[model samples]
Target: MAQPSLSMIVEGMIKADSPKPEDGWTLGWDVVVSYSEEEINKNLASRWEKHRDEMIKEIETQMTEERRPGESSDEEDERPTCDIKLELGAPRIQFVSATTSPTVNLLLPVRKGSSKWSDKQKTSILPENSYQICLKNIPLGTVKGNYEEIQDKNRSGKLPNPTTGEGECRFENRVPDHDPSKFEVSWVVLDFSMKEGDLNVQGQMAPGCELDNVEDGKTKVRLARGLKVVKSAAEAFFVGTRETKFSPVFNVLRHALVTVKNKELPQQVGGSRNLTPKKFRMASLKGSEVKPILSLFIHVVDGVDEGESRDLQTRWGGLWLNTKEDVMAPIPSTHTASILIHPKLIYKDVLSRSLASESNKGWRFKQLVGVEGGGIALHAALQCEFRMPSIRLQFDKGSGRIQVTVDDWSKDLKELPATIHLHQRAMDERPVISVNWKFSTETRRTNSRSEKVHPALDVYKEVTGDITRWKTTFKLAQDVPMKTNSTDYDITLEPDMGKLSQCWEITEEEGETDVWDKIKNFFRVAWLSNDEVFKDLVVESKESMRKMIPGFKLGEMGLGFFLTTNLLNPGAKVIRIDKDVGFRAPGNLLLVGHVIQGTDEVKSGKV
Candidate 1:
């Protein structure tokens, strides 16, 4: 047999100015439920009787309407199929946990007071003017039909119900039960200190509170068994503050009263978890901490599915008074699990800009706030273009070539081709530079009248030039081109006299006289410097000085040679003969060209 439903019994005391309370209070909730058979039970038989009458009426009306304004309503043989219900029971309540042990019962303190107060007195009464409130959880249980057995028997023909229409039907009900072994019964009593006009209590009362169990046909429990009172004072002190003028008490005490007369009620009877007001208040010079608390019960009706289990699990959830780490208390038996989380930021954003100068054109970046790792690594692509120093060059239109030999100049020339074509040059006070075009292929749109047929050219050229040659080319372009007729091209091609015999330079080395000669010939042909011959003469004179004197300083010998000859001259040569002392040259070889060391330097002349 299913266990009978349990109910709560409440008894309390309160002031006269409060709502009238019933004997006790109880709340009903389903822990497990069978399908709702209320409609099937309430209207099965009654509905069939009504359907029979309606069908007869409808058939008669249709028959009458079908006639030509004069039809007989004689065909009323049809009967309704539905039936009125003979049995319907009210919904029942189920306990969160079932009682496995027969001796299961609820235990609570007969008196509502703190442990500290209980130690002082087994039973204590409130002050004459003080308000008293009480709250506690009540135990309740439910009863339901054995639906599984009912269904099984129906399949076995123990219960008879028609498979087709126009017959009686049977339904199975699945009820919930509480396992007493699964629950820990404890009472949490709240004694509120409420002030006047601050507490409000409302409820329903039958033929007055004087009714017996059967006075009114309805089952009822006393919500606030006797009365609920609210108390507060405009001018109140913190304990003994009223007797001490130097006390730092600033705020008054606010209190409310709640009476608990039931033992098996759900949280719906208790209202919300946070019932305390959150109004800000000013404290005295010596501030005091305010700790707010909320209390509620968690009801875990047994035999519920996963969804209902999870939904009902959050019987109490909100901000607790303690930090998450400190809230290490064990979870209550009423819930599957409990979690307290504290979320915070890892890092903050630092707004800043690039550190390098604008000329560098190198992109710099800063880290965003709270990205990841200690330092986030990010990669982004940057494309930048900048202008290089301008190089202007003038070219000779005849040869259409600007020849230049540059040294010690470093610029990016990888993108430039070996040869360039000159088209334009810039002019300014600064010396001109010759720019050479590096050819490339590109497609560029052309402005056209017809939108459908846009045109483009496939040619791109860049200019690069050396500074000295750039200036010379610019000057040459400014002057008229030296004329050389096509017929006299050969004659004009012959090396110019001024350039043909120009001496070139050669440097001394440990070896390679032959190399020097080859280099001299090549450079002289090109009208380069005359240093090659100078190097040769210097090498020979040093040998001569070594032979004439032992252990002679190389620096002294170099100086001596410079004094004896214009060492800067590449065409210079020492006069000597085979087994002979002197050989004569045509021109003077004075060290300073006669102008510096001539006899009193004959009349100064200007070039």
Candidate 2:
């Protein structure tokens, strides 16, 4: 009974004629598991002594913090209860596939190389449908005979998987045995190239049915996009496949799912009786040849109604690389002209009980750089405010609203806090725009109070025409009087039109449409709003701002911004002169809107 040398396997059944084959008999039902319990022959009473010290320490600390309170818990005197159950559920759909599109490789250079940059090489993609979409499935078997073969192959293994080594994967497809109604999705395996959040697009069904690619020679088409919904657990099934460079790219555009069969197939002489959901599509052709892939379309077709609470999952994700799909040549063309650029701000902030800790706010500005080269560059600076709860809400009550607040309110917003500073010193201005958000935010501040004199105000000239019908709500902020470098003058102020609509383009009816006065005011104020010392260098300037910068200590901060009197203030922060912003290279330099941020570092360094 206690022999390690003697080994035996029980197989024969007590019933007679059990070995006889039958249609209802399961050939795989003969598997048995061996259990071990050598320690049962020894004593377990002494094992508790080994953990006795740790047990006592835990018990002693349980009452330390809560002992001061009179409240008690029933768990303290009586041990808590535990319930264990072994409920079984059906397995979910699981599939694995592979695809290739050389265009997906284009993202590598963009992600690895320095962004917002250009080289001698042209950014292009390989022909679209040139790459084949190869999908192979994994097989599932429970037969002892087949399992034994699999073990033998692995022992003399040239590869871990022998079935896929020479043959394809096959599985029996089945049907749902439950109800339908609710939906829940979760990812057991998540890999994202550029996923922002939840599933905005799945399969070919995108939000708003955007166009994916052109077909009628030259008609406009929407860009194809995809997002992941969920992933399954590895234990749900073992998945093994070759690693491909285009690994996640295929999933970003397409996906696979498992489903049950509606009816059983007639078990033929060679084929099994299982059925699976199958999908296929034809690729578009170009002039008798398959054209290179330019975009993707993600579509999802409902194939299973496995009852209430269906789960959608697949292994999905992509590598990081900004999405840019335009071609810009050395010379300008129709596509290169009048390009519309949209800026997106990504905010990252922390909420906390303390006002000082909560004020830490920052944002990331990301966009695909255009080829037009005339697009505006951007920089950000901001001051944050956080308001705490007030006790006054508890006393005043006609409203059923709960007026809870934080302990303190952060910095004041009256000073025009968030600003996107426009550094308009040159035209060849594609300066590398990586900024330390904290440092850049603090760099905008000056020791003198007049530095914040709203720049947008200087351009909104007093209305010469009749405005009796206009409400006071439309007018900008009031003016402020500040003296700088022995020059005392009142500089007009205006709220940031960024928070409102601002007209920078001029069309017909200048007075009725062009708010150039309102739009240009901020730059004038920002020019003069320099520090106390630089306020002197800008005093009734005879020479240009750029020429004088190299000779002075403050030149390192970059030049061109100077503000004096109304007549003396430069027309705009953006000025054209040789060597503008003191750039050493020869290229088209551009500056765009600026963003204001807050930082602990005050002194200016290379941003």
Candidate 3:
């Protein structure tokens, strides 16, 4: 049966904006490091070791200063928020550069046709046929170099000068090769910390904040909180480089060599209770986040971890994912060979727990160079799983039904029951008719011959009864129509003598018998009333049936008066009838075919 269905809503639970369980959530900075060939070579990687050493030294100095109770970083961060932006430049990944060049002043004699070559000696390529000379490829776009030269002496009017009286020239012809870290783009937690308020209110997001799993985040996540990350599809950050020679012959006879040592990030958790190895460069929170932790994790979406185990039991440990991986790394980014060859040049560290954003907006990451050492010369940032926040649900529509044990009636129903009951009483009750019904072993048929006569209902109707103290097989006394007609919505008992007869024997004084009644009264008119009677017994029976089966058209088929011989008169018949019994009875409605669909618009079930 299909009663018109309506969805039941449960409020105050999770909504559409809620994060899903599958999206990993963590509490750290989503660090993005970017670098370029120019920035990494001459600007950073060339002198990276020196810069790293200086950074380590600076960190050590600050660590010493921090140990002294009187020193504080607060004093340095006291600048007003407005001036800080003007004071700070773009977030930079810095490296040490050579303090001095290996150039010296020299005077060479001017020659005949090579006077032009001699004038531009410092920046030009070596002569093609010169001895002890080498050749190298220049960058694709550059056709000239930036070089400065000075005269050997103050010249007055003299004969045509040769070689422009060469003096000293100093210049840089090409950018040097550097490691990936030198090219890295980085930011500091201190900068973010001091200006957190400004960053949070900005209308952009730091790198890796935009994700489909994170709703409205493309607009909600802002980068004003931190610097935007440099990204490509293949790597978190990438920068191309070119091979060059200061002098055409420099790569041959005695190729110049520059060696920069690696700097170890010797960091220990200030407040942790766990024991970690002294040589550990990255923050090892007693976990295997090593292989999996990257400055940024790429391509993690519904398609990545679909069939994989995201459960605690199947995790690296018996713990859940406490970190949120980066979801926004660009698709075409790449990891350079510099990263593979020189790992220490890459700096990474986990920050304090408080640096993470409420949403995956950004992470508060740790840096090896420390807060006091961040600069264009120092490479510092975080490396760990980027865990973020998400939402989960526990219920759905197919859960069948539930039993609500409402403790406070007013709170749950909002006092609707009282109002409902009052309103229900205002509607008029349906009209009803009543009749008396009883069942007993005492029937009008007292002989065995009458029982035999009434045995075959298909043949004809006959009168039969029993006078013994026994219960009747019939449970109800139903109506038998005198004739078929369309006027009835109720059952009425009148005189019937075509085969079996039933009548109401009411006490009355017949002052005079009309001609029509006198003739018919002989066979069927055993009652005086024009219509069948109804009383409390019948009305109550109908009401009881209505209450028993809800949403039903009660009394549409007429009410059946139930009777029992158990209480009032044990051997007497309270209900009298002569008819077919059981499923074969004339008044009983029985469906005989297979029930498929239904046409009742008010309710459903039908045959």
Candidate 4:
């Protein structure tokens, strides 16, 4: 036998018309709640019992007190002796499938109760020609009487005498007697529609009951009034702050992403850093118009300019040292490490770029700051630019993976002064003139000098060489498994270094020199002198790129949790999950699984 399957898809856009079951995939949900007719009746009966005395007192206040025919006017008149009973019929719940949204029709029939009137004396209190009074105007249950039988007797001039107690005499003012069991006043009809994450209910009076004096119409109006109160209460609780209609779901998502254990993400993708998500939004996919994709904007961390301070100090300090004839002479240079730092080094800018558009692609960070503290040794600036590719989440059937592509990266050393002082001399001595240089890996350059006289020249060579030799593309893939218990399920992603690899090309500039040989010669000498240091730097750069995988995994897990938890019915238990679970294009996360309905008793068993 095939297992029952359930699929839930949150589309970018929903049609006005509700989807039908025949659409192949049903809305992922399980009915874990039910109410029996007997249970409903019992509850109603208990409510009536609690307020029965108060209701009777209210009815008594509306009734008029009349004395017996033989009683004296001076004597205190006795209150009318009255008794009332209420009964309820079985309730019926009807599911309306043809409506635009999910709708339920609730029907409850009320049975008319018999009433008895009594007097203290055994004698008839009514006069000979007296007629039974109708309390139709009273705000109470409908009254039944034999009006037709009495009218016929009156037409024939044969109305029963009340003093003889032979027959009943109902006045024309009394309500016409119909079937005792068919009282419209006791019936309740309510329509409940589930639309746009809200519950709307409407009360309708029973058929043929239009008068406000009628019991059925009055009850229906009161029920409608009560439902309005309920709707307001529901809105207040669920629509707190109005940030999102489903704030609880978002809260769960935030908790899952922040708390879920993904050790590989911090260690491999980005170093040990806190993942602070600033804001989240949902939007449609670009071009395809697939809607409801979740996007998270993270707080930006300051990118360390370690090379800036170190390189600037070394270059200027070295130039000062090179100009001195004696190596032991104290340098007069005033450049300090702190003053050489780049302005706006801290990255605190908010991420406002759109990730949905293919043209825009990813988040971009760029900054330009004048190189500081070289004094007369150097006058230059640095321009840094990098792009963080958009993270794509895909799931088809059962397998799921999160991916990111990083390619755009460039740094330029601009405004390099053309003259330098190689030797200390008189104040008016002319400085050695050199050709202008734009040292950047992004562009090609030709230098007259063969030897690396300054550290900046070595840096340019190193950057160009590394850019050409290192693998330009890095891709990391890992399996995210759903952990399930009898009552709940969770998704966890751990980075697998074994699955991490790099294989892609970076577009090269035209007419660029092939400097692989020159880089090899330079690295050969450096490797012999500082092999461990070079190895550590390479490891650090690779580790930084690796961190992207874990970060993407964290996002994927958060989205998965948001979708799954929303589909779950309160108190429902996970019975089985199909092996196939993943994301689909056009913006959809599909989960095929089975859940034990909340109404069912769940036993202690493995999921």
Q: Pick the candidate with the highest lDDT.
A: 4
lDDT of 4 by residue, 49-79 (tens): 3322221110110112346699786966556
Q: How many backbone clashes does candidate 1 have?
A: 52
The lDDT values for all models are 0.17, 0.17, 0.17, 0.23
Per residue, candidate 1 scores C-alpha lDDT tens digits across 62-143 of: 0011233554547564322211111111111111122231111111101111111212333222112111211111111111
At residue 255, candidate 1 shows an lDDT of 15
**Model 4 spans with C-alpha error above 4 angstroms:** 1-94, 98-102, 107-501, 506-556, 559-569, 574-579, 582-585, 594-607
Q: Least accurate stretch of 10 residues (summed lDDT) in model 1?
A: 550-559
Top-TM-score structure, candidate number: 4
Displacement of residue 103 (Cα, Å) in model 4 is 3.9
Candidate 3: regions farther than 4 A off: 1-31, 36-607
lDDT of 4 at 558: 20
User: Candidates sorted by TM-score, descending order?
Assistant: 4, 2, 1, 3
TM of each candidate vs. truth? 0.13, 0.16, 0.12, 0.25
lDDT of each residue in 149-236, candidate 3, tens digit only: 2223222322111221212112112213443222211111110111111111111221233333245543324221222211110011
Q: Relative to the unseen true structure, what is the Cα RMSD of model 3?
A: 38.8
Could you tell me the lDDT of residue 91 within candidate 2? 14
Preferred candidate (TM-score higher): 1 or 3: 1
